[model samples]
Target: MRQHQNRSLKERLSNSAFCHFEQRGELPCIVVQHPGFTASLLPQGAQLLSFCPSGDTSWIWLSPTAEYQQGTSLRGGIPVCWPWFGNADKNSPEVQAAMAEGQPLPAHGFARTNRWTLTRLYEAADRVEIDMSLPQSHHIQSVWQGDAELTARWILTPTSMEMQLITTNTGQSTLAFSQALHTYLPTTDINATRIGGLSGHPYIDTMTGWQRKQQQGDVVFQGETDRIYLQQASPLRLVTPQRTLLIHSRGSRSTVVWNPWITKAQRLSQFEDNAWQTMLCIETANAADDWVNLAAGANHCLSLRLTVE
Candidate 1:
């Protein structure tokens, strides 16, 4: 007979709040908490970071850091930046020229640095809802002609996690941009883990001069892996010997999977020496080569769901 032990109330609460939660369909969810943010996860351990009154718990770090750097101020939670992805070099003359024309900011655009307002919070029978919005900033206006709005919603249950991002162009002309949900995941060993789901797809390796290649098998961790997967019709999967994480998306034209190990992690003060072995970045996005074109007075939406078994 298989022995079954029920979890203690404290354990359940801790898991539900900090680690896991039980919902319908025998699904379990994880919870991530910090001072200001409280988010739930699916049994598969996929977390949705919800911005709340107290603080945010989402991880934030530079390229070389393995662990997320803790923010000193309330304004510094894991920010979701848009319009541009990756570095905005301060020393680059080309970047400076763009700034001179009003497109100024550091790498990965201004969305992550800007503050977002929590618009709604409620609970349904089996799920919790969270909503946040980012409006056009002066910096954004200087670079782009019209106003823009980004609205994000998180709906969660113990068995599932869903995120929706809606971008609206309030300006006069069309808005061309790239966007992504930069998710940082914790693991036991990144090098030992193999990401499934794109077994036979093609990807562009940004680290290797943007070379395109067909994936023969599951994605394995080796050194520094930076790839933007184009035309990916398969779901993204992260499988360890002990756990498996599945990421599903709709309306996203691209996916980005990255890891900076060893020497890269050594350069960042925020990361511990072995931290890179425990984290991964698998983002569902429309970025880089695949930019979005939003017409004036129009809106575009992207959605992602995470599940673990």
Candidate 2:
């Protein structure tokens, strides 16, 4: 790590022993190597595409069919779902209100597709930090009300990885929206994975009439599963046959657990139907009744941390 800090940016890029930074064709990316972990980041949307601890393979399950093209949401990795959580047509009252009048709004807002500026990227003795910001411009003020900026930062330490999203409402009036770090995690098998810590919350099951139900035990995926657990922000554990993944978060109001089984999995672009068995999402979010009411000049932040046993 001392070597990383001593090297200049050019030297660091050229020296693979410290770090790797390159503009791959048009997609710029950076990979940091600390004694405890290795992590990668993409400038597009300020996304964290990969992370692996000293003795592990990749814990993030990136899609084999992911497209690295600009302006397109890559199939996997942690997607920054801000200003909204789903389709604008679906209409969470606050999300619909922020959209440009009469224009077809994109899925999960504009933060993910926009190219974010790297605010800071540095290596220290114990870890590496990469911070980025998506500062919205006035040219799109006609599209969305309020002046706001979104930032995502990654902290790669020896034992765990932390990612945070900070939103600042720079304009007057209040801003209302739901957001999430839509994170896709690796799984040995969907059937063998059990999610703990969501056992007692009231959740809306997306597969069956959007009905609300209480979770009785650790969540297990049998068929298709999409549920929004309201108001529960406890640390969660993903128990699989091979290992257990622990997730802890702060400033997050809701948790969404989703797995597209047979039918829905078949319809998704850049995703293989049978591939669903290898990955599942336990998203730390502010969705449903948990929408944020950010006042003028105020700020809000949501963060997630991951560890494994």
Candidate 3:
């Protein structure tokens, strides 16, 4: 038994060594080898993780979890939550309750927790693809009997990044849903930076003592800001004096931006102290109570590509 175990270990080591050797070349995809940077591609999309050695800048993109952890929670990297998209109720009751009946999932639906299968891995280009079948979940099947295909493709370039999500309805009936790419970007100071894009639109302010009002210019961060802007036609941009990160998307009809200031951040133990200043949530989504109905044999696609300059 001991000898067998040793052989197994040796085989595993040999496989790893050979994988590394095969990856060393002008391959189209490559895994990032830096201390805090790792890249992978599934049948869905490419996912990149960039963190400090101290584990501070750790960010994950499931390429499939696009809802941005709802408007309430946005500290744990950028999750692409999907299906029943945005808020059904702006104030009380919240959207989770509205989705309780006849709905296959909770507020933002159950796309995030499902285990995605990796279909392809490119060693030279740092890319991966993940794929999942929707309406296949036990909960979803009980509520809505249908089959859907969701594919997420993530590609990491030397200077920029890209993610694509494609959903196809394979069942006989139509599928109704909403989607979003929840992005949580790390920053030195959220207050110092201004979020561009929705310059002249009205926003429902979720901060203390502030009434819902129309924003005059580009949305700037003074204190804590959490609002879901309606019918925004512009792309989302996180602008700082030092750098600017542009989030461009297609097939999404709504956009959400959120930040938990000092008080809210303190209450959440996972995000303590000045963690608020280090992160900002800018999501590209389809919400505002909008439902997408895809007929059988129809497919819908949503994509968000980020470029940091």
Candidate 4:
């Protein structure tokens, strides 16, 4: 919201060949049009709305019916879930303690709804670098009293894209929180999709009463599926008929895989009733037993990388 910052952003973007700022639908977004790929970024939530390598369908699936209104998160791309994940009651006691008693907590925290300031932008022959941060304000403190700063960095290349969410505890107290890079990936067919590298891991089946279970083999879609894999660090492969996407992560122990097949898809916002057929969410996370705790002046980062072949 700083006038000088906006001026700098406009000036730099105006001088770029591959990147520019444009109004998409109802929101202003940054657009990248490199010879190798094209991507769109929204300042709200610091979200990547779309990314497509040259000659390929978009790897990031955005709902056709999605609205671009403010304060509402779009149905796809990488939604940054922070401070706490899922429900307020489901967070760790320390994280839950930060919230006011008897107040309703929004799912996935408030970071995604608040606008972030673009702090850095750089473009090169082979890649583009972008950095943004959430400015601290009374609106943030009213929900979670802890003082924390969040920054998002994006690195884009011809063949791949990487995102990093950095959290710094700027205040003088210990803080606890959970977060995720909720990436919605596109698939030619959801039923034909299989996720590898989680065969032997333990998971919490949120769809089945949060039951603890072990994965039998590759994960495949049937009905609605929602599972939280615990302590996961290995790379995962999302295989479909047309192509395969390799997903890598760092600074995260938990991973979440979700798909709303039929029943729930109709009830979601910014989503078509049948939109679940083409998207799957495989999130890199610090969640549940793997929640993060940062001492004063400490910082933590959660990153995700995606490559398609």
Which one is best on TM-score?
Answer: 4
Greater lDDT among 1 and 2 belongs to 2
After superposing candidate 3, which stretches have Cα over 4 Å from the reference? 1-37, 40-75, 86-105, 123-135, 142-146, 204-213
Give the number of colliding residue pairs in candidate 1: 13
Q: Report lDDT (Cα) of residue 219, candidate 3.
A: 76
User: Across residues 204-256, which tens digit of lDDT does each residue of candidate 3 receive?
Assistant: 66564335567677777667777766666645677764567777787776677
lDDT of 4 by residue, 1-309 (tens): 545554666776898879897866656788999988899988888899888888988888888887887788888989899888989889889888777665677999988887788888888889988999998877777788778889999999989999999999998989899999999988888989999999989999998899999999999999999999997956899998889889999999899999999999989988888888889999999988999989999999999999864
Model 1, span 1-309: residue lDDT tens? 001211432253452323344442333333445333456433211224332323322222222321221211111112354665665441223223323253445556665544444455555555666666766656566754446778877766555667787889877877776667777665667878887777677888878887898888888887888888877554677786546767888878778887778888776555667778877777777765566777899998878776665
- Give the TM-score (vs. native) of candidate 3: 0.69
Which residue pairs in model 4 clash with each other?
A: none
Give each model's clash number: 13, 0, 34, 0
- Return the lDDT, model 3, position 1: 38
Task: Report every candidate's CA lDDT.
Answer: 0.59, 0.81, 0.53, 0.88
Give candidate 1's whole-model lDDT: 0.59
Q: Order candidates by lDDT, high to low.
A: 4, 2, 1, 3
Ranked by TM-score, top first: 4, 2, 1, 3
> Relative to the unseen true structure, what is the C-alpha lDDT of residue 241 in candidate 1, on a scale of 0 to 100?
54
After the best TM-score superposition of candidate 3, give how far the Cα of residue 169 lies from its true spot, in angstroms: 1.6
- Stretches of candidate 1 above 4 Å error? 1-79, 88-103, 143-146
Q: What is the lDDT, from 0 to 100, of the residue 199 in candidate 1?
A: 65
